[model samples]
Target: AVLKATGAKGVAEPAAVLAAGGGRLLVKKMKWKNVTVAIAEISNPLSVSPNEPAL
Candidate 1:
């Protein structure tokens, strides 16, 4: 299980989690838009070119 490291509201938020190595994840304790969010991992943002297929 994961959790917040602290409870004190700094009246400001921390740095972006994704930039901080959150691995592209997001959780909504309360629904702001009442919508679900899905996350997927990218093994490689760059794909092999059709002309240069991998062996």
Candidate 2:
């Protein structure tokens, strides 16, 4: 798998969400050329948004 070959975890579509801390999928997998992408909304975001400013 990708993680095994690249030593990078969660580079694949199926594992993307889980890698992002098990959130809902905002965007499904899309493929183009030699790339695959997915977007996930983390259940617990670790950082405050830039617009919100840190407290």
Q: Write the per-residue lDDT of candidate 2 for residues 1-55, one digit (tens) a residue.
A: 5678888765655566786677788888777887888988776776547587422
Instruction: Enumerate residue pairs that collide in model 1.
Output: none
lDDT of 1 by residue, 1-55 (tens): 1135455432112222333234333432322354423443333435535687333
C-alpha lDDT values of all predictions? 0.35, 0.71
TM-score of 2: 0.55
> Which one wins on lDDT?
2
TM-score of each: 0.22, 0.55
Candidate 2 wrong stretches, greater than 4 Å: 1-11, 46-55
Least well predicted 10-residue stretch by lDDT in candidate 1 = 9-18
How far residue 16's Cα lies from its native spot in candidate 2, in Å, is 1.5
- Runs in model 1 deviating more than 4 A are 1-31, 48-55
lDDT of candidate model 2 versus the reference: 0.71
